[model samples]
Target: MPRTLAERTAAFPEPFSRVRGLRELSNGVVLLTDWIEEKVFAVDFGKGSATPIGRVGSGPREFRLPGRLVPLPGDSTLLNDVGNARLSVIGPDLAIHRSIPAQRPGAAYSMSPRGVDAAGRFYFEIPPWSQGPAAPKGDSVDIVRWNPRGNAIEGVGRVKGSDRPSWQREGKPRLTPGIPMVMFGSADGWAVLPEGRVLIVRSGDYRIDCLAGGASIGAGPPYAYPQLPVTDADKADAVATFLQDSPMSGRGPNGGLGHSPAASKEEVAAMVKTNEFATHHPYFRAGGVCRPRKASSGWSGRFSAARHRCSMCSTERAGWCAKCRCRWGGGWLGSGGALSTR
Candidate 1:
């Protein structure tokens, strides 16, 4: 049985402007990335200090808009440098060991890394919603497996694309009105286990499906959860939170990446007035699934749609285990069951 533990805070010397990624290394050093600041830092929580890992630039040793931090074998970590369009390996000594291109040779789209295996092969997903001529057209997206040694990219599995409310108007597609710009709708989630198996969380039926080498191995029983209705308060809250946390720059009106200013107060108020919401929350949160390094269990943190703070649940080879709620970000789980947040 999973029980709640006493909470404690590891305060840093300076407050981060915006923390996008956080991961605890084997040596107890926490590596964090500040997206808005476009920098990465190595923080010693016991010493109450932080040191910048790499400079902020497009150079080899530097990175711009450092995003997800994926833990690799041999005490090393993989940093997704979104702005530089590459992945960098942070060595055990806290130095840049090498970098890998985000896009493979002769590939049309860049790779969005999700997890890494023990043998150092990367599992990534190409953006299904990629715009313009190269955008993939389909209701499903491919989960690609890439081997760094041989530079081979293969399709390992397929999953559903994002579910957004849109319709055709004037012979063109347009977003549906009354829909909150951001809502916790049903969508699929996936993560790579330490043993190189992929776990896909199907939201439609609330089930866990396992895959290895592009083949379905097994599946757990479906989780029976209530469909909680969305209320007026939920719509208002979602809009407020979205505006508050959104970046001041580098976002387009349709919620894609571009150079546009943040939405104005009037625009937000209009959205709230016309915003529609789903009747129920998704069975599992999207982009919230991750497995701890060297652990048999996989964990999903937080239930934003249900308004449950710090709630976590685990899925193993057998089935799902609902754990006690605890305060922490939805990052990697420690071996001893400690939740490391971002």
Candidate 2:
């Protein structure tokens, strides 16, 4: 018989309304981003203290809707200020050092920083579609690499995006209504290793594809997991969770990227419950890829809706390495090389 590993939970003095990002700093502190609170915190788990970094504003030392925290060289970290449409760098002293525009000069679009490489190149995803009159023109999204030193951007690879169901009014040709619920949506997951290698996890076939220097290196063997059927209980739980965390209702003072006015709880619940659900869950969920460090294997953890658990798999040298099980939630690689989930 094999022994199962026990799970450990880290407790903070105060609870976080919504935590979107986590990164281990060079000085053994964990940096956290609270999207709903619109703040950044430096949490020292060993000392059991979380210190707020800055205030909520659009000024040099302030930020709005602080999103992902990307670790950069030295003891600095790159923060995505989604509301302010820029990136801020925090030094080892936990102070804002500088800010950079999220969008390049004359570029039609701005992107969030997805990953950073050893050579200081940044990676971003250009979605295949946008809301309103422009719909998905294709099935794949492009991954671009940006070298800030030369202000150069180049297409490195392409990955498939999710295909969720939507609706449109009978007489409104220009209006594309949003889907209230997508029960078994599938989308591609990707991450960039510090060594400049990109790994894409395909949800359709549950396979891993590898790219290096803008060229295809190889692909890993597909993991054969059963697509369990959805149940009534699952549908009820999904709706309840969505209602509790809906952006329309939960957006703070920043107003949430220009969404419609907040919908009443009852109205939102009714709208979500009316949407049709899939019979079975997709192979894997999107946005679940974990960033890998240099000389380490890449990990992709997919939350299985049917099983109510997470299925974690690793890729090494573009080949399948191992598989494991864990609780369903976002996680990060700790300094001691352990996986910590919340």
Candidate 3:
């Protein structure tokens, strides 16, 4: 049974400042990545304490701004250190076994490292968003499989075609070039399931897709939740949340970046007035596939409405199950994606 939020349970010695990712290891040990701390910690709920796993320096075993920590099949862990632009593989003993550069010399990183499958493959994208010099010419894929041993990435598949924005509806109004819009559930809502199947929610229509073996095998039914109309207050709240949570929002007190401490009043107000949120309000949910079968209805659970933080359970909230042990990627709130335990 899922514990109620009011239930007094095991709490870490100190609250986490900002959690970037979570992975459950065997023997009930939970691996967590703290963005603010720039390090990984192994928390043993049974013992009610967290032990720091790696250093926060730029050295071999250190991580700068980490992305996600994926617990692999053989008790190894894949860590995405985005600030340092490297992927460090940590062994069971909490040691860095190997580190791979995340970005290639000439290639751009579309999506940051999201997940690693059982086959030792890392999943992300090279979409070529409009803002960069390597912007795509109206063509780019959203999923790629990177093999660490070979030091290469293979295209897995693209997001569903219908998910693309429809500029035609508004006669293609002229907008600023390079302004970025995110994919389904933002960039964090994607996850690679066991057996190498990839699942992503389609933001355009709130549909979930299952891609595997280099093709999409199925898309889940539409969300049961009604799409709420966005209001000025809603927009303001969304923008404020972004400014508060985004790691790259802007310069910090230290003249550096990475989720700066509460922005100054003037800065926050300025950003709210000037910056624009996506016109097509970002739609997200807590969901995932229960199995890797090719049936159109292979997925379970309906998309639920999300507030500031989406903590919906794709399946029953029974801690970690066999299928979602890694949970490498997640949505904005670290809890938006399909959930199933079958």
**All candidates: TM-score:** 0.77, 0.78, 0.67
CA lDDT of 16 in candidate 1? 73
- Tens digits of lDDT, candidate 2, 1-342: 111223344545566766777877756688888876777999987899999998888888888778878878776789988777789998899999889999888676777777888888898886544333443344566788899999998887877765544442223333333453356566677888877889887777788788987888998887766666766655665565454443452344645452234456566556556665787766555555656433345565443332222213321211111133222333444553433333
Q: What's the distance in Å from true for residue 23, model 1? A: 1.5
Q: Residue 149 of candidate 2: its Cα lDDT?
A: 98
Decoy 1 TM-score against native? 0.77
RMSD of candidates 1 onward, in order: 6.5, 6.7, 8.1
Give the Å error, residue 213, model 2.
3.1
lDDT of 1 by residue, 1-342 (tens): 112344434456576755667777777788888766777888887898788898876677887667888888887889987766789999888887788888787776777678898888899887654434544554466788888889887888888756544431122444543442237567677888877899887776777789987999998887666665656655565675555444333453334332224566677678776544567656555566777766755566424323332323332211112242222444544554444432
| TM-score, model 2 to reference | 0.78
Tens digits of per-residue lDDT for model 3, 49-107: 88887786667888777766665667677788766667888888877877777666566
